[model samples]
Target: MGGQQSRQKHVALDDPESKYVIPQNTHKIKGLSRYMSAKADHDRIVATRGWDKHDENMQSMQMLKGLFKNLDPTVMKAVGDIRGDIQLSFKYDFKRQLLLIKVIRCRELPSKDWRSKMSDPYVMVRLLPDTNRQGEKKTRVVQQCNNPTYNEIFAFQLDELELMDMKLLVQVLDKDIISRDDVIGEVIIDMNTFKFKENPVHTAWYMLNKETDLSITGEIDITVAFQMPQSLFVTIHRATGLAARDEGNASDPFVKLTIPGTSVLYQTQVLKKTLNPEWEETFEFPIALEELEDRFIIFHVVDEDVSSSNDSLGQAIVDLKDFDPDRGMHGSYKLADLRNTERIRSKWFQRITAEEFSEALYAHSMSKQPSFIFQNQRTGKRVNCIVSS
Candidate 1:
C-alpha cells in the first residue's frame, strides 16, 4: 500500500514530543515547557510537606495528643499509629494438598489511634489427622500473645503437628481478662473458601476501666485451651479487685457471652467480677465443632440494652477436631479409657477439696510468692498460689 497516487497530497504531523502549536481544545503544554514533566508530577505531593515521605511520617507524630490515661497502651507508650499493617498467616500440608489460613487485615478503626478497634484474637495450629491410620489422632495447639501490639503479624509452621494438638491458644493480654468476654474485635479468614470471615466463633476481648487500680506484675502466663466441648478456659487476672470494690455496677463485672442471633450458653451474664481478681472462670457454650456441617461457634458480647451487635467484640474461628480437648485426667488420653482414668485421677486429688480450693484458693494472687498448692481434682495438677491482702 505504497503512495498509490498521492491521492490528495496528504500531509501528516510527525511531532511526538512537540508541545508547541497545540490545539485549543487539546491539552496545552504552555506551562509544562518551563519545568520537567516527571519532576512536576512527583513534586505535587512533596510541595505541600516540603519533605520526603519518611520524614513526613515522622513529623506527623503529633506528640500523641489525647487523654493519655484513657487511650490504649500503645498510644500511652508514646508511639503514633502502628509501624505498619498487621498480618497473621500460616499453612498446613497434608497428603499433597495445601491448606492455607491467614488473617486478611486487623486495621484500627478511626477512634483514638484505633484503640477501640483493637482486637485480641485467638491463634491455633493444627495438623490434619490421618484417617487412614486409625490409631493416630489429630493434634491441636493454642497460644496467646504475651505482648500483643496493634496490627501485630504472626507466621509459624507446625512440624508434623497433629497427632496430638493442632489448635492455637490465644489469651488476650490486657487490663481485664475473661474467658469469652475479653473479645473487643476480630480478624478472620475462612478455612474452606479462603476468604475473610467476619463473625467468627468464640471471639474474645478484654478491657481495663480507668478508675480501677488493679495492678498486674511480671508476665502473667495467659493460657488458652478447650477444657470441654462447649466451654473454653482462660486464665488472666493476676489481680482483679485493686480498688477493693464489692460486686455491684463496679464490682460484679463479668464477661457477658452472647452469640449473635443465637441462644446464650451461660444462663447468667455475671460470671465473676472485681471482688476477687485471682479467681478464674470457664464459659461453656455449644459452639465450635469440626464434624458438623452447620458451623456456628461465632459470637459477640452481651449487650443489656440492645438486641443487635454490641459492637461485635472480637472474633475467633475454632475447630473442635483440631484442638487438644481437656477431658480432665492424670492418665494417658484415649477417650474410651477416659472414665477408667478418671478414677485414678480422682483418687490423686481426693485429699484436695475442689469446692474449698475453688473458693479459698481464689484469695491468692499471682503477683505474690506462693504459700499453697491448688490441685485440680481431675488432672491432679497443682497451681501455685499466694495470698494477697
Candidate 2:
C-alpha cells in the first residue's frame, strides 16, 4: 500500500493534470512521509520568493518618488492639483458692458488617441441657454499636446439685466478632421457668483466636468417717438458710411424695423447705387406705454440683390428704458455688425410729435421777410418795404 501511494504521488508531480491528487497514508509510512516532506519544502520556497519580489517592487516605487521630487515643484503641484481639469480667468468691464474671458491653459488631459498617445485640443466658449449659436466663440487648435497653453481672450457683450441669467460654458474638445469633434471635458461658470464691481478681473482655476445640454445664437437705426398712452412712431431717415454689398456698384439699401414679440415689421423702399441711402419713411405702431419697457427696437440695414438673396449690411438695437414720451429721443446711431459685434456706420434719426413737425415747418417758412416793390415805381422816388408773407 505504501509503495502504491509513493508511486501515485510521483505520478501526480510528473503529470500537470493530476496536480490535485490527495495523500492516502494515515500512519507513518516511509515512502508516503518522504513525499509529504518534499511537498512542504516546495511550498516554503515559493512563499519566500514571493516576499522577496514584493520588497523589490516597493523599493523601485520609492526610487521613482525621489526622482519626481527632484523635478519642477510648480509642475508637480499643478499635476497634483488638476488631476483632470482646466483653468480659466475672467474680467468684466462695467463701462463698456463687456465680459472678457482668458483661457489660460489646460492640464492633465487624457489621451484620446491610443496609438499617438496625445490629442489635438481646442477651447470653445459660449453663453449658456443660447439656441442660435450667436454667443459661441472658439480658440485656434493646438496640435499634439496634452498640456496646451492658450493665452487666448474672448469677449461677450452683456447688459446688467442680461447678466442675471448669464452662464458661461467652457469646453475642451479634441479636434478631428474626418470625424466629429470629441468633447473631452466642460465647465460652466455662473456669472452671479462673480462680484464684478469689487474685483473687475477675477482669475481662478476651475474643474472640468461633464458637458451641458444648453446651446444658443442680432440688430438696426431710427428716430423713435412714443406718444403718450399708445403709439410708437419710428422714422428711418437715412444711413451713411454703409458697407457696399455689391461688387461693381454701391449697395441698393433698405431699412427693416422689427419690434420683438409683436407682429410689427416695417421696411423702407430700396434705394439704388448708393452708400448713403435716404428712405425718409415714417411708421407708426400702437403700443402701450407699459409695453415699451419690455420691447426692443431692431433696425436691419439690408442690401437688395437682383440675382441672389438680399444681404445684411448692418443693424442697430434700441432700448427704450430711458425714453420720455413728451421729450422723445433722437440721434445718429452707429450700426453694429452682429457677426463681429463691431460698430460700422451711422444713421440719422429724429423723434417728434405731429404738432411739433407742423410748428417747425411753419417757423422755417415764416423766418424769411417778404419782398415788396412799392418803392420801385417811385424809385424814381424809390422806397423799399419789407412785408411778412
Query: How do all models score by TM-score?
Result: 0.18, 0.39
lDDT tens per residue, model 2, 138-240 = 9999999899999999988877678768888888999999999988877777889988888888888876654543310011235778766687877777888
Local accuracy of candidate 1 as per-residue lDDT tens digits, 238-294? 322222233353333222222222233232243343333332433333444442333
Best by lDDT: 2
lDDT of 1 at 305: 23
Please report, in order, the local distance difference test score of every candidate based on alpha carbons. 0.29, 0.62
Model 1 residue runs over 4 Å out of place are 1-251, 258-321, 324-389
CA lDDT for candidate 2: 0.62
